[model samples]
Target: MKRYLMTPGPTPIPPEVSLALAKPIIHHRTDEFKKLFDETIKLLKSVMQTKNDVVIFSSSGSGAMEAAVSNLIGESQKAITINAGKFGERWTKLVKAFGGVPVELKYEYGDYAKAEDIQKAIEKNPDIKAVYIQASETSTATAHPIDEIGLMLKEKYPEIVFVVDGITAYGAIDVKTDRWNIDIGITGSQKALMLPPGLSIISISQKAKTIIKQNSNKYFYFDILGEIGAYGKFTPPVGLIFGLKESVSIILNEGLGNVFKRHSLLAKATREAAKAIGLKLLSKRPVDSLTAIVMPDGINSSDVIKQMKELGVEVSNGQGHLKGKIIRIAHLGYFFKPDIIVGISALEIALKQLGVEFNFGEATTKAMEIFSDE
Candidate 1:
């Protein structure tokens, strides 16, 4: 059986990156490591479309989310939070956990948060210090209109920092941090970055750096400012640092425009293929990172996942309330057209094996059409 990983992340790591990681580990405080570390940060900023400092952490994406709260906002500070997916819900939790007042702007699952809602929240709560959002809500498969929201925020409430959880959408979509006026943009290596789960990346604007000064939350390990100050002297995870360097090198070599275009083409192919197979898309404003398809009536998404696994393909099941209702197929990082073809073909066969009335060749044919057009 041919194997494939369609999970959102730790998406397949490129063999080249894996080989780099296998090198003998070196002390991070060494001058050689510092050079590589500095270069890695510069490359991260280039890919993230920001001139701000991009800080790296030896933690998951959640760590960056928490750091955004602890390092930026003070106790009892009010912030507008957009809750449309599991990741959005995480923003709410992180705010509350950090002793901030969370003014949640909720939306039903499977829908994007409206910019107008964000505006109203800011207008209603003039005391709001910041606006927290997920660039892509991976749980519900929705991509929030962050650019629109950012425009409104900058125009209306420039004081409110716009913190985005871009763990899934960072390299997968067009996240122009400087253009969109994003204050603090956070991502993880496991997602679109195509590395393992050990690294979290954060870009902090000069405005955000000011917020950090008054945050009052005492943090050490996740202290981004402290890390940046000591970058040339301190030790980081050397192996992961090398892995990140190699991964970012590959992405840069491919060119950002071409990388995004490839993801877009793969995403379109996946969505069109799903529709041709009579599957419903989960998110209204779907992100290019992954495609979530609603299972047919009486067919549990778990069953679909099980069948797909039997056929040597691995995709993610929905999270939280969406569990057992939708299956998420990712096309991010270390993936290309052939992988997309193989994955869709496996899904079609698996659905048939599970007694779902899907036309066997329809998805593959539609995907081919998409591939040709692209």
Candidate 2:
């Protein structure tokens, strides 16, 4: 049976990146490798759309998230954390772990965060030093208004540091890191970068750098400044670096604007297809990275997932308390229009086999109509 991977992170790797990873590994410290590494960093900044200093880490996206928390929020400091979904909840935990107090502004799983709410929270707690949030919440397949929130902070709370975990947003969506005034923007290799899960990239503003220099934080491997001056504080993942170079090249070659359009098209087709089949979407403001569909009454999402896997198509179930309540299908990196067709076809078959009543033939047809129209 032919297999398809449709998970949010660890999305299918592009052939160019796979080939680059297979090339002979080089020593990380050599001048030859430094040239490639430096080029990779430059390419990363171009894709991230930021003029601030970008740092690459030899860890998953969460590692960069940790760095943002550790460096910016010192002990006894108050920070505002927006918890709209699973990834948002992580921000609150990270703040507490770093010895900072989190004044959490939480919304329902499918709801989006508003900039006005953040303003009110900061006004209530004038001592708040930082604001932490996600650009797109993966678990809920929802998008927060990062641009509005960032601009709000820049205009009013200029002293408050703004950090955004753009793990599922960077390459998939036009995040506009610099224009958005995001002090720390984070993303992983596995998401929109079309590579394996090993590298995490972050962009830091000068204001954030100054804050880090003054703060006395106790962290070793995740030291953002240490990674900046030196190519890497320790031995970098040379193989992944090579793969990242090729992946970023692919993105830049296709052009970032075109890539974002492609993702938007795919996401629209998926959401429209699901709606055509009488399924409700979980997210009120859905992102282009993935789509979360609410399971019908008396139907278990896990059973549908199992049936799809049996047919060689692997999608994901919802995370945390949402498990067995929703099915998530990824439309991020390395995926095209035809991939969406296959995924939707398999979903129709799975729902049919389980005796869930819906217009089976209409889903793919509607998706095709949208693709053609767009």
Candidate 3:
């Protein structure tokens, strides 16, 4: 049976990217490769909406997240982390692992962070050097108000570096990196970029660049400055980078505004379908990248996930404490109207098979209606 991947990361890849990945290997040291690499980075900046310097690493998205911490926050230095979901929780862990004090502001899952809360936290912790947040918390399918928070930081705390993990937000959602004053923005190849895992990206602003210049953090592989100085600083994921160039081109050609609208429609379709089927949404501030629907009491989300997979469609179960409680359906990358319809159709069937009481075709019908209206 053919499978449809509707996960948060490792999203479906477009055929153009697949073909680019299958091309014959080329030597990385050659000038031809250098030109291709430079061209790719330039196109990537367009997607990211920034003039800041960007570096790509061969590791996963977590690698870039590590770099943001290791290179800027020195040992015993303090950084504020907003923990709203599983991904936001990573910021605290990363800061601690690098011997930095994590002044954490924890929020309930499915909720978002507010700029005022961040302001209060910074006021309490006067020595904070940086702030870490996720533009879209994948675990809960929620989007924080990064624009407001970034602007607040720039106006109030100009010296504090601002870091954002935009793994699921960069390509699917509209995140203005330069206008938002994000010092370090991180993303991965798999999420909205529509490629296989292996490439991690980070954008650096001049403010963060200065901190890296004077920091003496004990890290080698994730050296941000070293990467900026050296194209990759080591062997890069050549084929993945090739695929990235093609994938980013596809996104740019489509136009970022249109791309974001497509994602917004798909997400609305998914969210409305879930509600039409008598399910509640998980996120208070939902993102266009994905939608999380709360499972009815006594209905295990894993069971719904398994049933969907049996019908040749794959979705994700919630993480951490939310596991078995909510189902996450993705419409981020390489997804169109038909994809959303089929995913909702499979979900409708899965819920029926699980003996949940609801209108059998309501979800699919609602999704189709949403697409037609769009």
Task: Compose the digit string of candidate 2's lDDT tens values, residues 278-348.
Answer: 99999999999999999899999999999999999999999999999999999998999999999999999
- Model 1: which residue pairs collide? none
Candidate closer to the true structure by TM-score (higher is better), 1 or 3: 3
Global CA lDDT computed for model 2: 0.93
Which runs in model 3 stand beyond 4 Å of their true positions? none
Model 3 accuracy (lDDT, Cα): 0.93
Model 3 C-alpha lDDT per residue in residues 1-374, reported as the tens digit of each score: 99999988889999989999998888888887888899999999999999999999988999999999989888899999999999999999999999999999999998999999999999998899999999999999999999999999999999999999999999999999999999999999999999999989999998899889988788888888778736745877789878999999999999999999999999989999999989999999999999999999999999999999999999999999999999999999899999998899999999899999998999899988887876
**TM-score of each candidate?**
0.97, 0.99, 0.99
Measured with C-alpha atoms, the lDDT of residue 241 in candidate 1 is 83
- Cα lDDT for residue 211, model 3? 85
For each candidate in the order shown, give its overall lDDT on alpha carbons: 0.88, 0.93, 0.93
Question: In model 2, where do residues sit more than 4 Å from their true spots?
Answer: none
The TM-score obtained by model 2 is 0.99
Model 1 segments more than 4 A misplaced: 232-235
